[model samples]
Target: MATPEAPLREILKSVSFTQFPLRVIEPFFVADKIVKPRLYIYPSFAVHKETMANDEKRPMLPTFDVKSLYMLTALKFAKYDFDIAYTSEPDASPDGSLPFLLLRDGTALDFKAIMSKLQQNSTELGCATEEQPDYISDVDGDLEMPKNELPSEPVYRTMVENNLLPVIEYLTWTDPVGRECIGEGKYLGSYPQIIRNMLSWIAATDTAHKLKLGLPEYGADAMVLDGEVLYENAFRTLDSLLVLLHTVDDSRLFLAGAPSLLDALVFACVNVFLYAPVKSPVRTALLKSDSTYKPVLEYAVRIFDQYFASA
Candidate 1:
């Protein structure tokens, strides 16, 4: 008798529990591929306004922002091609944060994720031009430094994020002068006055909570922030940064021979301290004659003039 034919369902079932595909597609997640990227940054103040002799108006100076400036610098340093769209709403991002990057394939990456993606150096990410070199040089051998050596780039980065960032927040949200300079109109300029005021109050409340200021205290109140402790920590952090800056060879623009992430961060912090319209004692300290922070002040100016001044 002819071999009994199996049921059609049985024939269609796999003979083996595991079967490998005959060919592998190059990229499994085609959606993750990046073409040109777009960066969404908070708008900066138009700090400088000038009228030309010919009755034409000159472009206003772009002010520095702690978050936006660093992200911008990092992308620029990577030689990445991108378009910048300024928005006041953080909720526009995938995770409700400002400074998120949008890849052409609709991928939204936060700051940490963006840095991680850049480090992957994937060709599909389109971070570099076809004709340009793909590798970014690490000027200092910090990556491979001995454990006991001066603090590495990672260490410095942590110090800035943890220590310096809070000070900036304190200044912007809790200081009277800073609040005035960063008026509600800066971000919510398009909204109606009533809505703007309401949103501003909500934002202030949220900031107060985040900054750990006690409830029932708001807007430049003594309970909002401890100026003594804040400035003390800032001074210590600045001193550490000054020491790090001194380690860089006089010839290089950044800690790394090339512009590294740390350079981006340092530039952002110092630039803001120097030129952001806020009345910060740190700015006074940096600019004072015979200031201990001369290198930092100079570094900020140099980076701005070289990279961001004309932008």
Candidate 2:
């Protein structure tokens, strides 16, 4: 009997980096049984080196080696790779331009080892330096804002109770819209819609319209009434949701507990709201409501501190 010709090798090839989005890539590599090799082009290698030089104290901003960051972050919980399958032909100045080879053999690689390799590679390329950015000081300085100066608590609670929870539930539930809204894009629908609705409710100055829509009037508070109520509501709601999601130990409260898909889903939603450009009523409302939402903001900060802060 003739020996089979090695059952014809199957190669999985993709042009994108394995760590384009760390969160998304984490699970895919974890679960993949077959070859899922990715070819990452270090297009921002020079820019990344500059960013690292600017931020001296912190680990270099790994723009070119984002795959390494993903691996490091994942290694906080799992393991992943370092075996070099191949390296591209060296050009005249291949220092930052050459693409490094990576192979996935379905083995759990050491995170520290991979990080060390990346650092070593950077050093060999003469890119290592130490000059921390001024932005770091700015961030550190803002942390001292006193409690009394922060936003109020009641307004924060109202936001959570009224807006964030409903939006999260609507997104996660498998009802009419939920069924069709599968995959990563599902979370987008509810947040934008809710923000739009809240803006509409706030913009309607007519007492009758406010009453019909079940929106409360700001009474004689000219500042809040002017336009700040909407953003106050949004920030408060967002903070509450972050607190609830981050603190609650109950798996039932979210689609899954820590390390589940829900964590990513909710984190993305809350983060977008946090960073989104505020406009009109929302911007005005947030400015006035900031004092009232202090506790909630602190709670949000604390949660982030607990999870993301280095010990």
Candidate 3:
């Protein structure tokens, strides 16, 4: 039933149709042993419309879905139509609990492994990697592999891990306005108040944990005040990122030329930053950019226009 008491992973993992009135997209097999289409589950940004759509199943998806989606879209060589399940979080995935892919037998592949497997399959099947005019490095942040062979990777990793992710967590969990948005939009709409509050608390606690580990200087102590500190640090990093983004040329529209995994990751973060219904400090930071952060804004719009315009 996906009760609030149960871990999100349990709710997400149970594939039984009776669990919720959820749709179980059936797969079509080309042969007795060959599965054709696959099932993909990604996080959706729990929009207000989604919560209002139904009474029972109110699982919210993460903005992280966009990254995997970008990889799928950019891989022009592969020809597979995957059915999607927009699921809720915090992801109980084997890979840091992000989004995942379910196989015909219900085997789940976490995000990074999914990309690796796809790339390997494309090679084994003799499909050439997309020779797209731009030579963007294919550096997916979630993949537990060697860093992408791009000069921008270290900066990208720092921006994502240290700056962007913390700010996102702060907005989604710590900020008062962000808490309200998450409560009403992601949980409260479908869950009882107690359950939804717990979800928000857990999310905030996780945020603090992450802040403690990756960036102690961002202030993990005293959350109310810490939230502001985190925002300042996030923008401080973004300030530097803006410098890098400004210098980008046409051969690569995003970090490291063509659309690299960093672009997808950053794209997802920026979308949330720019679009969250709540006016968190981070959003305020962008709004205050007044024109100083023009490059960041343009980059986000450009990606959306190029990839998600029809999505």
Best by lDDT: 1
Badly placed stretches (over 4 Å) of model 2 are 1-257, 277-303, 306-311
Clash pairs, model 1 backbone: 139-257
The stretch of ten residues in a row with the least summed lDDT in candidate 3 is: 133-142
Best by TM-score: 1
TM-score of each: 0.70, 0.23, 0.62
Which residue pairs overlap in candidate 3's backbone? 43-61, 43-62, 44-61, 44-62, 93-97, 252-257
By TM-score, is 1 or 3 better?
A: 1
Q: Candidate 2: lDDT over CA atoms?
A: 0.32
Model 2 per-residue lDDT tens digits across residues 178-243: 222321122222346666445333333242243232234645554234233434455665555545
Ordered from best to worst lDDT, the candidate numbers read 1, 3, 2
Compose the digit string of candidate 3's lDDT tens values, residues 131-228: 42111123222222222346766566556767777776666666677777754455344677787778777877787687653355646555656666
